[model samples]
Target: MIERRLFEFHFANGDKNGVYHAVYAYRNPDGGFGHGMEPDTASPESQPLFSIMALETLDEVGYLTKEIILNDFMPYFQSVTTEKGGIPWMFRPKSDYPCEGHFKTVKEWAALSTTAPLLGILEKYEIDIPWMKKAEQFVWSEFERIKDKHVFCYLCVPRWLTFLKYTKNQDKAEETINNLKKWILVDGIVCKDKADEGWGLYGKPHSLNYATSPESILHSLFNKETITSDLKELVNKQKDDGRWDTWYGISEGTKLEWAGIQTLWALKVLNNYGEIEK
Candidate 1:
């Protein structure tokens, strides 16, 4: 679809300005992203996870400027961060912003889902804020506490892996990798529905449930052969409208945002594998 073309153009032309603007359009005044960049959290208020998405999107397009990080982004994140140095997944919503599901502001806790990548992002820029140092300690402590792979928090594995990989924390990295291998490789990705998961709206967590092939980020942990079937399934599951679908329980607007992100991720994997021409 048009989003695919935009994604293709993003990588092919080496122009990130358009992509940056598209993503930036969702940025809240607080310097964090909102207005449904994450789709699941439609709250216009600054949410930590959506902020991570914003930074990652900027990083992906090479538009992660110091201005964005130092002046605009960090302040907002810093303000919302808890005393323990961990960021809650979401915060209180703006009066006009409608939130649902996991998007609502509840008990705030530093989540691996948010902190790991936020740490990685900070490290990438060499921006050593106080929270960064504290976050490292918190992450390692969390790692020590988590003795096994958590299925409900399965969506967060890659981000934690990325954090470990970036920090070169071999011990935690190996443990996480092994845990993921046991869960996904040995046990298998679990979802509510097994029969019709290929359509994109299935509740079951397949290899492609969150993004592209599992091997995209976890290549060191898994070979192409292991996830090749799922990768191929991604290509086969493309809807006639040119967008790959996702689960339908979320608001349609949120679903569309996720579809855009997931579709771009899928294209990236296919392009990397030479399955699709650039």
Candidate 2:
């Protein structure tokens, strides 16, 4: 019932209050959220990665107000952002906090995964702060720098596309998307050895389609047939208990949070595709 209520309030009723209560439990006192909201990292300390999740959730619920963005969230982000204006992948608390084994951040480096979604959140809320302009620069530069490289990041693609989708710079957005397509499709990252292989964009759990709901820009990279197939896969993965299982092995408490998050994502994808009654 709790999971149903959470999904229905978020997907059908547009209930900001319900979503807020669900999200706020993880918020830290310092205005960022980190208390294992990600399930991989169990620290109450504010993390850029988890903060992006919280902000994106708020935006999804239409609760990302200017006041909250500028006053509450931006300050913590400003404190953590690199001199180059890009936020790090994470900033773990110095104090003793619960952390999974092998927990680490990029440490003094900007990460596209964290920075792009944060940019998307700012764009969604229409907050044109000065830092955003700098972040925009970083996103493009990083895209160009890594586009031709042998490496690719499936997790960051959706987030980067989200930022591009709402970006005011249409020309730049188009250019960046073109580059991404080359890296993902033309360069063989989408289906490297075979479909569903390691790091191939679509096959993995929480892949591009799973992360990016109502995926429009990526239609070229992932065809309608593929999208439909992936959608069916998502449906098939739902458990008998009505919650989708997470791929991670974590503590029981964090496991519950991760399952809830994954369930929310699955419902969002279903609701986006007309599978849920609006």
lDDT by residue (211-264, candidate 2, tens digit) is: 355556766566566667667766776789998776455678877776786687
Model 1 misplaced regions, further than 4 Å:
1-14, 92-96, 147-154, 186-195, 198-203, 208-217, 220-224, 252-254
> Which lDDT tens digits does candidate 1 get at residues 132-174?
8888887877766764545435457667766866775677677
Q: lDDT score of model 1?
A: 0.66
Task: Give the top-scoring candidate (lDDT).
Answer: 2
User: Ten consecutive residues with minimal summed lDDT in candidate 2?
Assistant: 193-202
Flag regions of model 2 displaced more than 4 Å. 1-6, 11-14, 148-154, 186-188, 191-215
TM-score (C-alpha, index-matched) for candidate 2 = 0.81
Instruction: State in Å the error of residue 44, model 2.
Output: 1.4
